[model samples]
Target chain A: MQVEFWFEFASTYSYPAAMRIQSLAAARGVTVAWRSFLLGPIFQQQGWNDSPFNVFPVKGRYMWRDMERICEGLDLSLRRPTRFPRNGLLAARVVCSHADEPWIPDFVRGVYSANFAEDAEISDPAVISRCLETVGQDAAAILAAAQMPASKQKLKAQTAEAMERGIFGAPSFLVGSELFWGNDRLEQALDWAARAAR
Target chain B: MQVEFWFEFASTYSYPAAMRIQSLAAARGVTVAWRSFLLGPIFQQQGWNDSPFNVFPVKGRYMWRDMERICEGLDLSLRRPTRFPRNGLLAARVVCSHADEPWIPDFVRGVYSANFAEDAEISDPAVISRCLETVGQDAAAILAAAQMPASKQKLKAQTAEAMERGIFGAPSFLVGSELFWGNDRLEQALDWAARAAR
Candidate 1:
């Protein structure tokens, strides 16, 4: 079955899922597609101007601790990013520009690690440029192209596509027509994908 | 350290938490006070007339599978109950009436098992009566008391108290003045309780 992982670079739980999804999907003999999309538009459509974590302090504190525990259990690196909900506009644009490239998954994972594991402010052009360079892509050209009109339009189109799919959060998975939300639902999504393929 | 477990008998996730809380608390040398409360009023205050699980099918399905996995991982028995969001009024009253009783925790756990492990409809007086009888309590007298006008009022008052404490879900725990909602927050609540007690 073909499974598409829809993720946002700024999402906390998406970090672990992005880090392990490739190997896990491969082990299950499933084909995976990586999708980088911004959750800002989806949150606005849901009548929210910000992440729910920023809206609820108690739940937010619990989320941070829970993420720590989950990351430790998964043996993944985690650093609470100083700049949360960083503007992933440039990152999203770059991913959209290379939407058809096989290395898009690697780029998405690199961006996630930059924001979540390295505590870098992903809204900074330098940070995103560094991430692209780490993945062996030409940082300057990718950054320049990402800001091009066509690339910006493509990013907006992808966000609109996610909204049409009823996506309201990061780390969502789409298998055929079914949408599974959250990192917690990754296993079920994978199972559904595997069954669909069979 | 002292910990108070605020749970509802009809709560899906509370069954496993109730089954393990005592042992886990004991191992940590912490005392646990089991307080049974109804979730109906909380749901109402949250502007919902039913269990969130029943209101959202996708989340409900995910919860069932997640509970199954968590129970299996813990070597605990879990049977999905037929009648969900059961009228926990009577059961809550009984716990309130026996609030000072030390054996109330065991009785609460028994009720949880009857609902979640035995797949029993806990709203039925007969089921609750059977549960009470197993704990060597006067089923008829307790059932009669649980149905009293005063008992019903007490249940309402306790639910109001839960809302005031910022509780929005079942199987919550109170560590000092902090309220932690859901069974998944059990360990973190205990840890907080331990630190607070010190």
Candidate 2:
């Protein structure tokens, strides 16, 4: 069975899910389809120009504290990004453009680490280039490819498709047509996939 | 160690939480302080006249589906309430006024069952009266007590306290000053309480 793992680079909870999803899915003999999409468009449709966490300050404060506890439990380092949500467009294009490549997973994890752990400006090409290099890809070539019209268009279509599939947030796991949202539902999603296969 | 479980009767997820929390906390040797409060005020403070799920239809659709899976897994019966977010005010008053009484837990669970399992209108006095009677309590006396000025004030104060404690949602757990939101975090909150006691 295959599980589609949808994520956005700037999302805090997606970081932990992106880092661990591969190992967890592999253990269950499930294929992981890493889908990098933009949450900006999705939120915009909901009449939100900023992250819901920012639009609602009370919820925002609780989210950060929750993230700290979640990260601590998972042994993942989390530094609240200096920017509430760095523009993840460039980073998302990189992943969406080379989604099928073997090194895509490493590059994906690298970008998440950069945004969440290292607090690097993810929208910066230089920062994205470093992530590409870390995954042993040609930084200059991939950077050029990511800027192509086709590459940009692919990411746009992916985000639109996310909405079509009933996705409202990042770090969602889709086991067939059944949607499981949030990092907390990761285990349940995987178990569902495993059980369905049987 | 003590864990304060703040819940709302109209909340769908709170059904499974209310049904299972007592046994789970007992296993951890933790005391549970049930705090029943209203979410209407909290949502209004965030400029929402309705449930966030209702204000955002996409979220509402997903929530009902999510609740179905959650209840199925826990072997808890769930039926969509005929009225979405049926008023829990009167029920809250009853629970709040008699919170220290031994029958509070059963009454709380009974009310949740009425709304979620039986699809009874929790706002109806007869419905709440039946719940109180099921717990072998004096339905007339408790219902009368729930209408007293003191009962009304107690619920109001409890809701205000929920806001002060940064509770933006229902089924929240407070272990000391640490807050854990959603029913999924029940184990984690209980674990935190157990560990903190050490």
Candidate 3:
């Protein structure tokens, strides 16, 4: 009944996917597990020091424009962040801490909107606290708990598991053992989930 | 008016794009100008000695599966080439010589099918000759002409032009100065061409 949605807060395409996944899944009568993981460790294992977009200049240029065009097509506002790929470690830990909370999706969406739409730096604790508060969570308590060793370890373990599943990208979906990478494959992944239910 | 269809012979995605472009373009009342170029020079400029797929194992593994899924969806047979990205230089020269030929579309399709679908070695003159013959061109004469210094220079210059336009991959489309990379962008590129016509 549920597909796992693996995303990273720093991933650009993951922004739109996060914004769209919930309602689209509901319409198809499928539930989704919103899992937040970091892509940094994965990229590092591949010997990339920074985003592939940054490593390849031409690809990077096309990516920014592509994101603009995609957002326009989706009727979503996208303001280029002043600093690209602001650290999402703290945000991820917060998300991991509430992985099962009913309000987690809203909190996740709030953080993504703040980063991609409002040109905000998500690495800041103030932004993370605001996202938590917006979803009616206790900002202080969640932020405090998110930094605990246990919460940090959970995030670490999830990221390692992502790499173990042969995941090399963000905004990926998993229906059992089938891995569908990219936001473009969301529908197919959901369709796979629906058919598997039958 | 025509939009530029820039493709690399060794590109897997380019296989379907080459196979489907003509019919699809004709349906949309659009004419396409098939331009043969090499990604070797482009990849080299980015410091990649081999295909990015080869340079990154995880990406490479995903690419093969992705190509299989895409080809299945398109109802096209895809056989993994014995050697990935079999040297396509000779093939591009043959294609460049026929850049304006009435039968060039069929010729391009023939080469892609030979490489991706028929388990043929495009780098071999005999195979290149066969692809030409399949399209009703004089195999010996075309292959000979394709090897001449003038013909070789045409492909070299075109590859240079593609780089000048910031093309880093295959199956790209150009509508004026706008670059649409990937087979996925084919429709959008044609739409831009149609809109620009008005």
Candidate 4:
């Protein structure tokens, strides 16, 4: 099945998913198309200017605990990032530049780890540069390319596309035309992908 | 710490929680006050008119698998009931009538087992009668009383109260005025309860 993993670099849950999607999809004999987009515009469209976690405390607390349990079960390391939802503009731009390469998965995972595992301030240029260096890419050139007007326009267009596709959150898996939201939907998304492959 | 366990007899996830809440809470030096309520009205108010598990196929499939994983991990038995959501009306009423009894936990467990473990149609009067009998209750009288006008009104009022309290789903736990929804939120709820007690 042809599956597209639409993710935002700043989302907490998306870190675990972005780290695993490549291996999980490969095991099912399915190919994944990585799509990097921003959720800020989507949240704005919903009449909210921030993540729901910031809006609701009790639910937010539960979400953190739930993520802890899930990450432990999956044997993934997790550290509460100092700055949640750090700006993904540079990260998104790098992914967009390599939209046609198989290296997109590695790039996504690198960004997620840098933000979530290292607790780096992803909005800062130094943090993003470090992420690029870890992924064996030229940080200086990548940063320059990421700042180009064309790259900024591309990121905006992708966000607009996501909104039009009825995607309201990150870690959304698109199988053919079906959109499955949330990390909890990961297994079901795989099932749909397998069935589609058949 | 004193905790209120708001449960619906027909809820799939509530079975394991109902069976374990008392023991788990007691082990933690906490007391649980069992509160029986119906989820039908809540579903109706949300424009679902049915459980989200039944309304959304993809979500429903994931829930069944997720429930199995959770129950297995918790060392609990789970079977897909013959009826999706048995009319929990009679069961809720019986529970309400015995709300003052300390044996209410056992009754809730029995009802959950009958519906989720035995694949019984909980909405059916016969199934409920058998469940009550197993719990040593006067099935005939209790069943009759469960359907009485007063019992029916109590059920309606309880559901209304849940809505007034901003409860959108089950199994919800309230510590002070804070509402924590879903079984996944159990740990956070307990933590909040502990802190509140302190």
TM-score order of candidates, top first: 2, 3, 1, 4
Tens digit of lDDT per residue, candidate 3, span A47-77? 8889888989899999888899889999998
Give per-residue CA lDDT, model 4, range A1-198, as digits (tens): 878888898888888888888788888988888888998877775445777676544346666766776788789888987766688878888887778776667777877888888787777888778877877888899899889998889888888888777676788888876777778667768878987888
lDDT of 2 by residue, B1-198 (tens): 999999999888888999999999999999899999999999998889988888999889999999999999888999998799899999999888877788999999999999999999999999998998898989999888888898999999999999999999989999978999999999999999999989
- Model 1: which residue pairs collide? none
Model 4, residue B72: distance off in Å is 1.5
Task: Output DockQ, candidate 2.
Answer: 0.84
Scored by TM-score, the top model is: 2
Q: List the candidate numbers ranked by lDDT, top first.
A: 2, 3, 1, 4
lDDT accuracy of residue A59 in candidate 3: 92
**Per-residue lDDT of B1-198 in model 4, one digit per residue for the tens?**
777788998788787778777776766777777778888877775456788778755456656766886788788888887678777778888887788786677778888888888887777888888877777778899888887899988877887887777666678887766776777667667767777787
Better of 2 and 3 by DockQ: 2
Q: What stretches of model 3 exceed 4 Å from their correct place?
A: none
Residue-wise lDDT of candidate 1 within B1-198, one digit each (tens)?
A: 777788887788888888888888877778887777887766665456888778755457757766886788789888887778777777888998787787677788878887778888777889888888888888999889878898878877877777677666778888776666677678877877777767
| DockQ of all candidate complexes | 0.16, 0.84, 0.69, 0.10
All-Cα superposition RMSD per candidate: 5.1, 0.9, 1.2, 7.2
State how far residue A120 of model 2 sits from its true place (Å). 0.8
